[model samples]
Target: MLQIYNTLSRSKQGFKPIEPGKVKMYVCGMTVYDFCHIGHARVMIVFDMVVRWLRTSGYEVLYVRNITDIDDKIINRAIENGEPISVLTNRFIDAMHADSDELGLMHPDQEPRATDYISQMQGMIGTLIENELAYQANDGDVNFAVRLLPRYGQLSDKTLDELNAGERVAVADGKRDPLDFVLWKSAKPEKPAGTLWSSPWGKGRPGWHIECSAMSCDILGEHFDIHGGGADLQFPHHENEIAQSEGALYGKDRKDDDAPFVNYWMHNGHIRVNEEKMSKSLGNFFLIRDVLKSFDPEVLRFFMLKAHYRSPINYSDAQLEEARAGLVRLYTALAQPAPKVLETALDPNNPWAQRFAGAMNDDFNTPEAIAVLFDLASEVNRAQGDEKQLLANLLRSLAATLNFLQREPTEFLQAGAKDQAGLTAELIEERIAARVAAKQAKDFAQADLMRKALLEQGIVLEDKPGGLTEWRRA
Candidate 1:
């Protein structure tokens, strides 16, 4: 009984896949012209969380996240770099994968590149034109006839006139209406060969909006369970996707088989910095690799998931430190040794697990679900022996559903912050040995001094029975 906030309907609806126990989801993925920014991190992590939860709920999921390898931005970036479009895009695509791997994102089931699906895009455009839902302009650009589709602005919840009024730019020379968008753009003479594809409408490339429509339809069919992207795409991008996909398949006909393009539309909120919107012009844009230089990748992922996916999250060093501290506490509990734990799947009988499920079922409310994790951590800390092991096992199991707490607790706890170079492992161990010797020799002052010195360097020392000492970065 999972409920998803369907953006198309503007309400949370019970999720029922077109095929029972199977979900076909398509997310608009990165346009690999440049390094991925923090904004891209949110999209990658948020949808990844969704996919993880669906599988944990026992639903088989086929997640398709399309990459826009060919676009206006890609073409321009290649020109700026004085390289072939393939080289420019391939470089960034690899960089994107590296970043995704750092963030621990699962590879999508089908990562269809816009460039590879040129024929599929052309076929959809051809159908749109034949159905009178699109037109070939005088300039040879085939544009979707937004006026022909009555539900043009349904996803955005605006009428055509209202949408047209909000437009800042006047109609272009070849467009029939100001609201009309290109499905196929006529190739420019100066554009590189890599950017152009031969189509029925002459040599050109797929429009940005049409890329998702064709890729999703070709991979997941016309009507799928879920379609998602960032909230900024809700207006022109996703709305155009609806128009293109539905118009091509159903056309402007009567009420015959009124199946929508997608059953659910999900959009995650934006990432802001210091309470202001993140943008390059404002100098707040951060590259994922650059941020990873200072903070651990897990810390970044934790920071991204700390806030509810639909709620805007403000980014700052202070915010990241908070996320790091919270993760540390959980890992600290997990680092403790315990007896064998037998639990595997989430236990319905466990109160904590039930609460976790309820939170996840309610529109994937991660904030509430994460709160349950902290509660489980508390129980794990308070319990003893086998009870402690069971609770700890449950905590890890539940966290796995959210893709948290998968790494070795020691690995995560000892990794320390990338920016911190205060105490090396060798130095920490040497100090621990010195402190142990000092304690053994009854030199109380020297032992206290060794402990204080290590503490000063952000290392916390915990003395155990049988004269064993353990340390972790603070």
Candidate 2:
């Protein structure tokens, strides 16, 4: 059985789906105003690992990661770029897919866009109005009444008084309370044309927080098995979701008859650089595309899994280079050919597999699970015949659960270096041939010089038995 740390409970608990053998998970996805940064990468990769593990654990998972295609950021970006909102969003959406493909992320089962559910959002807002949980302010904006709902700060574990004192909360003119958040924003005269919708509150758009509440409940029902996002969202965004969703479901009386909005809440920690949070405003943020220019996508993925999901991971060239070196070792062990064997299920009874499963079960502890892979790799290197083949298969199968080590070892090793350097395969082969000739002629100094030149170009040569030599990227 898998145990996950529930952010709401602040402790690890056994995972039990509301429906046996089934899970409905909703994760807040990208805003799509620009290219995804490393922070966004963490969210996508973390949840992708979770979904993969659930399916591997024999549960049917309905994964929905919603896209915020109609947010204020999207609108502003479209205006700045002088493109239609759809045009801007569609471009970034394609870019997001390219990035995701490069990173080897499994697409979510359902990717609900915010614009597609406008009617549902309006309906939910009306329910809040009818129950007096929300009200139309003098400025024609609809706001959720935080004071009206008892236990408003349950998720953040902060009282109304403390939240009021927090400097982050803005006191707008029309809002009754400073802590109250907008459910619907009235259209401004300068707002984009398509951005506004005719709602009961007037011509306006759904607020950022309300979009998720409506979309998640509309797609996954009023209550679901799990809700996940980055830890940054736990305070205002997710806390607001809980308030609005549960308020609409149970009404002002706040009865507990029906199911809770979400059974478990999970949050992945942030990515840091030099012990500071990685943010574009701080000049420390790296775009996924920018990072991929230098490091392989698999290397970035491995770097993230090297740390526990809930722990902060630092981003640096040194860290990525280290991860690249580690991947090379894993692939090197897989370079040797193994005896052919019939396909079979991953043996849960196998000790190594069991150990891997145990680490994964204990809150998706990927670092420890990766250690198990290294152990299997050691065994694969030492064993021969069927034993070696079995260990290699086990290594591949377990690593695949975390979406790693799927490429052919030699191909992965040899492919990328040439791209990094201004060299071609033909050039590398010619150099290798020259080095071989020099060695055969016993020109030891010439052969050594040739090797040094190739090494400087990021190509490494390995001499094997029977006068055979192989080369790969450094």
Candidate 3:
């Protein structure tokens, strides 16, 4: 009963998988020329949330996120680094995995590298050529004929004339039309050695857009349930993907065969800093590894889920600190002494769980769902005895769907910022002991001073009913 916002339809619609109880989804992944930035983080985290919710909703998902290992960027970067294309791509792919692991992203069911599927791409391009949807230009490059596909701009909601007039489409020397995009690029004499592939269109490589069309159809089938990527790709990249995938099917003489390239399209909004887009060219981008130095990985994840997936999230130190503080509150509630919890499965019948599911079902509205988590936390804090234990278990179960709150509350609460030096556990225990001694001596002022000192070091102390004290980092 989950409804998602489909970018193609430009509205929220009920999700119905092509198969009854299974979903086949393809998401455009990183280009892998450099380390992933915060923008890339949003794509990974957003789709991860979607997949987790789908599994929690009891549907089998075949998630395929493709890798662009043989793009122009990769070639140029390898040239600059004075290394082979394979060496450059493999190093960045490993770095990307490390970043994904740190962000708690589940590995896609299939990660097809573009370079590994050259044969399939060539075959698809040949099909388009036979169908007359694609043609080999005078320069030996094969380009998709955009004018032949009447629905070319449907995905981006822009007409061909609009795209052509808004920004002057550079009519490449050999292209017949200005709007036509290359399906295969011909190798140039000045190009690097390993960059070229023996293709039907001469020794060249696949174009940027053709890689996804070939890989997605080959792995997930010509038609799948969902296709996702960043909003920046909505224009030429995804629009061209739809054109090539569908145009290859019924070129020119179009028919309603009830088969489309993809059913639902989902796009995560950009990451902004001070009302400007976060990008390397703007010098405002931060690498995932660099951000993890100051904030916990879980804190960064929490910060992302705080906003709706489609909404742009502004990154700043203040926002991250606020996220850490909010996460501390949730962990604090969980750290309360209670009986052991065994069952963690979500019970949709439970009223709290019902509210949470309702929020999640309505277009994956994470902000609303997160509000339910806060409300549950408040309930857990207010209740007592077995009631508290039951509610705490429910809180953990719900958070697990979002891929967080799995850590022991005390451990997470006591752990300080990753790169900063805070009060150590031993030092904190000593301070607590000194404060206890001061209290026993009736030196209330001395005890209060010790308490303030620990608080200043980002530590919070709680006095239990039986003269026991608990300490956690704030």
Candidate 4:
């Protein structure tokens, strides 16, 4: 049985699917105001590994991550840029998807947008209102009365008074209680917004917290097997979702008398840059695309998993190069040619693979599992002769262990340095071709001078192995 460190339970609980063979999962997605960063990549890759491992263990997973295109940030951005909300959100979403693809994150089975489920959100709010768990304030804003909900502090372990004490209670005279959070916001006359929904209350947009609740319930039912997100959203975000959904969904669909939202709560740790958490305010932040420009996505993925998923990782260039070299070692082991045919079966004597599986079985300990892979790779590199079969087995088994290592050994072995050299070689080849043409024109002085210059510069031309002039650094 697999054990997952559930955030809500605050314990590593044995994972039992709500339904026998299927895993229902929903991961909170990007807000679409800006491009995805390494922080987002950490969550995406972590959960992806979770999903892959679950599938490997013979369970079907249904994953849903939502797109929060409608929110305060999106509205603020749209107004600032003087662009339509759709235009701004669409551009950012495209960039976000591109980053996700580059990072090798699997697309969720269903990626519902918040705008598509306005009616569902309003209906849930209506249910909350009717149940006296929520109310529409005099200002036409739908608010979740956290004080009215039973065990309101269960998820975050924060009392209603504690939350109110921590936060500067905004002087919204419309709300009767300080703990009540917005479910729907009434549009103000001064704000020029692009999206509007017609509701019994008034004209307004769905609150940030309401979108996920509505989207999740519409697709995955009142409850799911797991609800995952970054650790930062544990407070008002996930907390409010639990209260609103339980009050609204469980009441409507009495069959799910237990919980209205999710069975398991998984949150990935933060991404730091040199021991400081990457935040815009701290100026220690990087966009995913910018990071990818300097390093391969696989290397980034590998660096992330080096530490446990729930533990913070402080990234730096040195750490990245270390990961790059480590990945190269694995690929080098894979590249060694094998004997004619080898049995595909696991070697009962191969303790390395067992170690890998053992680590993985222990709550997806990827760092230890990776250590096992590296150990096997070292053994493979040290072996000669009929070790081809061993290398082949490693090539296959490592893929099962690390999804990022799906490339053929030779392809994967090419480091970023080599790719840079290849580009330089291409330019040199163009220079050589131009030089050859110059020589063919019978400009003896230019040819002699060029040939001498080439020899002086360490470009020793000879009958090369591939019948093409190849050059290597001296």
Q: Indicate which candidate wins on lDDT.
A: 3
How far out, in Å, is residue 469 in model 3?
A: 2.4
Instruction: List per-candidate RMSD values in Å.
Output: 1.7, 1.9, 1.7, 5.9
- Better model by lDDT, 2 or 4? 2
lDDT of all the models against the reference?
0.88, 0.88, 0.89, 0.77
Give lDDT tens digits, candidate 1, residues 270-356. Answer: 889888889878989999999999899989988988898999999999999899999999988787763233334787888898999
Q: Residue by residue across 1-474, what tens digits does model 4's lDDT show? A: 577887777888888888999999999998899988889888889988888877777788998899999887888889999999999989998998899888877888988989989999999888888888877888888888777775676678777666662353354658878777888888887566567888978999888888898889889888789998988887778988888888885543334346547878888889888898888889888888988887888889999998888888888988987888888767666655532333233444667656666677777899988887777777777877677665656655655545756666545543343344344555656766766677668675875676566556544443244534434321
Extract clashing residue pairs from model 3: none
- Give residue 110's lDDT in candidate 1 (0 to 100): 86
Candidate 1: Cα lDDT at 338:
34
lDDT of 4: 0.77
Assess candidate 3 and give its TM-score to the true structure: 0.96
Q: Pairs clashing in candidate 4? A: none
For model 1, give the 10-residue run with minimal summed lDDT. Answer: 336-345
TM-score of each: 0.96, 0.96, 0.96, 0.85
Q: How many residue pairs collide in each prediction?
A: 0, 0, 0, 0
Which candidate order results from sorting by lDDT in descending order? 3, 2, 1, 4
CA RMSD (A), model 2? 1.9
